[model samples]
Target: MALAETILRAVHKHDLVPKLTRALPWISLLFSFASVIWLLMLPIDGNYRKSYISENALMPGQVTSYFRESEWNIVRGYRNELKIFEGAAIDERNAVVEGWLKDIGLKTAYHRLHDPSVQDNMYAILHAARGDDTEAMVLSVPWTTSDGEYNLGGASLAVALARYFNRMSIWSKNIIIVFSEDGHKSLRSWVEAYHTSLDTTAGSIEAAIVLEYGGDSDYFEYYEMHYEGLNGQLPNLDLLNTANLVSYHENIHISIQQTEGEKLTRNDYLTRLKTFLKGIVSLTLAGIVTPSNGCESFSGWQIQAFTIKVKGTSGGNDITQIGRVVDETFRSVNNLLEKFHQSFFFYLMLGPRYFVSIGTYLPSAALIAASFALSSLSCMLNSGFTIPHFLLNISSVLKFFVMIELSSFLLSTFLPYLVKQTTDESDKISLVNLILLSMTSLVNINSKFAFSMISFSLFFIAMVIVALLILNFSLALCIGLLAMPLQFVQQLLNSIEAKIKVFLCLFVSNPFFVVYITGGLYLEAFGYQNGTLNLMTGLLTSWDDVQCWTWFIVMLGWFPAWLSIAISCGLGDFKNQAPVSYIKKNQ
Candidate 1:
C-alpha cells in the first residue's frame, strides 16, 4: 500500500497528469502479456473425442456387428497380400484393390485430387452400400510416396477395411475410401478441399478416419491414437469417449497419446521430439534463405517425421484387431448428424491423460505477450515531446518494423534450400543459434524500456483503483502480473551483485522473492491435489460462466499493469523536484 501511494504521488508531481495516469502503462502491459500467454498455451495434443449422433434419428454403435468371428482367415490372407504388393505403383495397387472391392459387391468410383503444394497424386472414393451416395464418411489410407517404401501399414489396413466395408450392407452412411498421396500434407489439402465452400471442387465428405499403419502381424506395444487435428480443431467429445470405450471393450491393451502428450511411449516420444527439433531447424534455415531466394515451408512428412510400421513389432495387437478398431471407430462417426461444434478448437495436452484448455493456459502465455504489447503501447504514449528524443524513438520504431518486413520477405524466398539445410544433420547448431540470435536481435532493437517502465507504473495505479475486481479471477494471474516489476527489480540487482553469496542473500531477502517462492509451492498443491488445473480444462471445453469471467478479467487487467509500471518509472525524478521554488528564491 505504501508503495502504491509513493507511485501515485510520483506520477502526480510530473507535468503529465499524475496519480492514476501512471497506472495506464501498467494495465496495458498486463493485458498484452496475458494475450501472448493465452496464445502459447493453446493445446496441440492429438486426442479427439469420438463423434456421435447429435440428431435424435442417427443411431450409432447400435447395429449388431457381424465382425465378431469367422473372418480371421480372410483378414490374414488380406494382410499377407499387402506385404507382397506394398509400395508398388499406385495404379497397379489400385487395380488390384479395386478388383477386390468389386468382388465384395460394393459400388466404387475414384476421386482424384492434384495437390500443387507438394506435387502428388491422391486417389479416393465413396463406397455406396445400397445405391445412393448421399451422405458419406471418409476412410482415408495414404498411398506410398514417390519413393518405394512399405512402412505405412496403416494405409494397407485401410485398404483391406475398404474391401471389408464394401461387403457390408448395414452401413447407413456411404464410406469413402481415400488413398492420399504425399502423406499427411496431401491428405490435409484434400480434406480441406472437401469441406470448404470456396474449394468445393473435391466434393463433400462427412467425418474422416485417417488410417496410418495396420497390416503387419507383429503387435505394437500399445495402439497409439493420434488426434491432434489440423489447427487444433477436435473431432468431437463423444468421438474421443467412444474410442476410449471401444478400445476397452475390444479387450485390446492400448494406451493413447495425443501427438504432444506427456505419457508418450519411448518410440512416440523420440519420434515427435525429433520432428520438433527438425521443425525448429527448418525454420531457422528458412529465415536465412528467405532474404536471398524464394522459399517454401518444409514438410515433416518429407523429413525425420516418425514412422511406426506394423511389420516391426511382435507383441501388442494383430493387424486384424487393428482393422476392427478402425472399423468400429468409423461406425461411430458414421452416426454423426452435425459438424463438430462442442469441444474446444484449440487446446494443449501435457499427456493423453492431462490436458489444458485454451481458456486457462491461454492467459499465461497471453499475459506474457500482452506485457510486451502494453509496454510497446505505453512506450508510444510516454514518448517524450522533446524534439530530438521523439525523433529518435520514431526512427527506432520504424527500423523495427522494417526488420519485420524483411524477415517476411525472406521467408518467401529460398525456402527449399532452407528446408534442405535444416534436414541435414551436420548443420544443427549453426541453424538453431542463428534463428535465436535473429529473434533476440529483433526484440531488443524494438524494446522501448524507458517508456515501458512509465506504462507499467501507471497501469499499477489503475489496478489499485479497481481492487474490487481482485476476486474475479484466479489469484495466480493477479499475483503474477503484480509481481512482475519486483521480479524485474530482483533480476536487475542480481545481475550487478558483487559476489555469488551476496546475490543469493539479496534474492532471498527481496520482498518479491518470498512471495514468489511461497506462491510456487502453493500452485503446485493446486495443480496436483485439487484438480485445479483440470477444472480450467473442463471450463474451456464449453463456454461456461467461469471462462467468460476469466477472459474478461485477463483482458481488463493486462493494460493497467503495464501502464502503471511505465508511469512509475517515468516519475522517477519526482523525489527531488520542488514546487514553486522560484517564488521561494525571490522571497
Candidate 2:
C-alpha cells in the first residue's frame, strides 16, 4: 500500500505540460531509447561472408558428380516430347509424367487435391527410396505458360529429376516430386493435403523443395528466395545456413532478398538466395517426415515458397548444373537426422542480412494500438451529460460497445445486398440521392452527428482498405491506423469548438502520426497482423525501412498544418480570444 501510494504520488507530481520543471514519465523515454537502439542495430546483423561450414558432417561439391552431360540429353529429349504433346490438359500431362517416373524406377503416387476455396486440382506424391523408405524430400514445379500457354517443358524436368534421383543411391531420404497444376493456391492446397495425410498412421514423407520457372535448359539464373511464410512462419535457420554453404561451394550468385531490400547487396543477397533454396528443401522434408505440423492444410496456410527467376544475357550453368545443385541440397538435407528445430521462425528481416525477433518488436505496436483504445475510452469517460440545473454524469460507456456490435451485424447482413444494388446500372440512382441516402442511413436516432461521425469514419475506413489493396498492404495498414486518431481528434475538435483543440492535435497527432505511419509499415512488412496499432511494435523493434521513413515524415507534417489553421481561426488573434458579452436594455 505504501509503495502504491508513493508511485501514485510520483505520477501525480510529474505533469506532461510544458514550462513545468517536473520530470516526465520515464516509460516514454525508455520506449523511445529502445526503439532507436533497435532501429540502428538491425542493419548490421551481418550476412554470410564466405559461407563457412556450419555443419561439418556434410561435404558439398567434394564428390565427383556427373549429371551435366547425361541430364542435358534427357532434358532435350523430354523437351522434344513435350513440344509434340503441347496443349494437353493437366491430367494428360500428369499421366505422361507418371509413365516417365515409373520407367525411371521411382515409386510414384498421385494425390488429387481438391481446393474448395478456389476450384483446382493439384497433383503430388511420395517417392520411396531404393533401400529404406524412412525419410523423404519433395520437389515441386508449377506450370507457367508463355501467353497464357502452359510450359510443357516443366513436366519433362520433373520427370527427368525423378529419374536422375532414382538412379542415385547416395540419397539417405526418399524423394517426393510433385507437379502442381494450379499456381500458388494449388501449391498451398497440396502441402495441406500432404500434412493432413500424417494424421493417420500412413505418414511417410520428409522435406520439400519447390521448383518454379525451370524451363531454361541453359545456365541456371537463380534469383533470391522469399522466406517469410504464412503469419510470419519460417523454416528452421540451420537449413538457411546449410544452403549458404552450398551456394559458396557451387560458385553461384545466391541472394536473400527480404521485403526490406530495394536492391540486392551481393553477399547478403547470395546468402538469402541460397537460404531460400534450402528453405524449400527443408520445408519439403518437414512436410513428408514430420507428421501433422508441416503445412496448415485445413486452415489454408501456405509454405514460404519461391521460384528461380533464371535471367542472364550470356548462357551460364546448364540444367545439369541445376540438377547437381538440387541433388547436393537434397543430400545435405538427407544428412539431417532430425527435423529443423534450431532456428528462429518468428523474426522480421529488416534487410536480407538483418532481422529482429517478435519479442523485441511486438511491444511498439501494442503501445500505439493501446493509445487509440485509451483515447477513445477517455472521450467516453469525459462525455458527461447536462440536465436543466446540474451536470448529470450517466456512465453509459457500454453504449458504444452495443452500437459497434449492432453496426457490425447490419454491415455483415446488408453490405453484399447494398453493394449489388449500388453496382446496378439499371437502378438509375442520382449521385446526390446516393449521398443523401448514405448520410440518412448513418444518422442515429438521438445523436445525429455522433453517429454521422462514426458512419463517415467507417466509410472512409473501408475506402482506405480498398485503396490499400490497390496499393500495398503494409502501406494501407499504416495509413489507416495513423488516420484513425486524426479522424477522432478532428470530430472532437469540431464538437467542442475548442480553440486549443488545434494545439492539442498538433502536439499529439504529429508524434503518433509518425509512430503510426512509420511503425505500422515496418510491422506490416515484417508480416505483423492488420492492426492499426500493432505496426508500432514493429517500428520500435525492427529496422526502419529508410524508404518508408520518407513518407512517414510527410504524414507527420500533415496534421500540424491543419492544426495551425484551426488555431489561427479559433485563437490566433485577440478578437478570437475575447470573451463573449451579452447586453440587454429593457424598459
lDDT of 1 by residue, 1-587 (tens): 99999887876566334322335456755565554444333333443222233344333345444553455566556667767776576666667767766676555554454433333334445455553555666656656421224434665566567667766766666766656553444444444445442221222354555555543543564554444321112334444545555655655543332232333433343443343322222222221111101011111111101112222366655666666766776676566555545444343333323344444453453354345444444443334322244356555434433443354344323332354343564475477559946754444321243333433433343343234222222233343444454323212221233235433433453323433443345433423233333233322221121112222222234333432332233223322322221212322
Tens digits of per-residue lDDT, candidate 2, 538-567, equal 222121111122122222223322232233
Model 1: lowest-lDDT 10 consecutive positions? 289-298
Give TM-scores for every candidate, taking all chains together and pairing residue i with residue i: 0.53, 0.59
Query: What lDDT is reached at residue 7 by model 2?
Result: 84
Best by TM-score: 2
lDDT of each: 0.42, 0.43
Clashes of 1: 101
- Provide backbone clash counts, one per model: 101, 27
For model 2, state the Cα shift of residue 502 in Å. 11
